[model samples]
Target: MLRYLRQIEVIGVENQKKLSNSSVLVIGAGGLGSAVITYLACAGVGKIGVSDGDLVEIHNLDRQFIHAGKIGIKKSKSAEMFIKTLNPEVEIEIYDDFGKDKSLRISKYDLVVCCVDTIEDRHKINEVCFKNKKPMIHAAISGFEGELAVFDFRNSGSPCYECIYPRNIHSEKNSVVSPIAGIVGSMQALEAIKLICNFETLNHLLRMDFRYMEFIKISISKRKDCPVCSKNL
Candidate 1:
């Protein structure tokens, strides 16, 4: 309680307790995952499950600060070490290979944060979250551009990632201006905290172009033919 004294003043004791009791699964250990994991752990989230199979490379250090001095090791393990060092009171789980059974893994946590880099991975996460009726915080970054949205699958009408960007649409470029990842990733963490504390979260896609300092909030609607979420409706 003393550790979160300042935060408690803002969110109140009950909300702080909610954060302490909540569990979150962050499914990437790259740039976005770094910020998401760091903030959530610092905020005293009860349990954090980090699932990333990739190895930490020197290039990743530019954005994935949690993996600092941890090259040549799996990102999940590195993240676990960082969280333990930052806040041992917060429980940590490491998943080196989450591809085996996403549904089983996702079902164990209260909320899912999709920090993975690729569009394909996002769709897979979206499908599984919708199936489990779990809330998901999704964000993506490329160069100076980034976007974020929350799909509360617990609500039947919530629009999912697929509803906004269909499977046919693909993006493989990983180029990103480093600070952009930090900015957007921090927002994802805030959104996750808000969702856990039962506060209002972003219901629309927030697109930002840092190079131009422009932000756009686009309303999202469920696609009647959305293969992931609409079927459930």
Candidate 2:
């Protein structure tokens, strides 16, 4: 409690306890994952699973701070080292290989944070989370813009990632202003904490343009024909 004394004052002791017992799986160790993992570990999430098969590269340092000085190593392993050093009390798990076949692994966590870079990866994660009926926090960054949304599949009526973006859309590597990743990633972590503590979370897609300091919240509904979520419905 001492470690989270200030936070407990805001969320209460019971909520703090909920956080300590919660498990979160972060599916990327890149830019967004770095911030998401850092704050979640700092907030005392009991277990964190990091899944990223990519290796650290020098170009990643501008945003992926967790991999500092660990270039050439596996990102999941680098993330584990960062979490252990930041909060030894938190349990850490690393997955060097993540794909569509890891649905069982997704079922083991209380929440899933989708911080991956590609639209395809997001679809894969969305499918698994929707199938398992788990809450998923998703965020994406490009240039000075980012978007966030929570698909709480625990509720039958909640919208999902594919509900907003169809699977037919493809993603290409985009340039990003580093701070945008931090801004959106931190919000993802906050959403996860709020969900674990039974607080009201964002029920709409939040789009931000940091360059202009603009923020927009758009209402989202389940797509009647969404391939991933509609089938379950």
In order, how many clashes per candidate? 0, 0
Q: What is the C-alpha lDDT of each candidate?
A: 0.93, 0.92
RMSD of each: 0.9, 1.1
Give the lowest summed-lDDT range of ten residues in model 1: 224-233
* Top candidate by TM-score: 1
Q: Residue-wise lDDT of candidate 2 within 163-202, one digit each (tens)? A: 8998776565667998888889999999999999999999
Q: Tell me the tens digit of each residue's lDDT in model 1 across 1-233.
A: 99999999999999999999999999999999999999999999999999999999999999999999998999999999999999999999899876688889999999999999989889889999999999999999998899999999899889899989998777577999998888999999999999999999999999999999999999999999988777745
* Candidate 2: pairs in clash: none
**Candidate 1 off by > 4 Å:** none
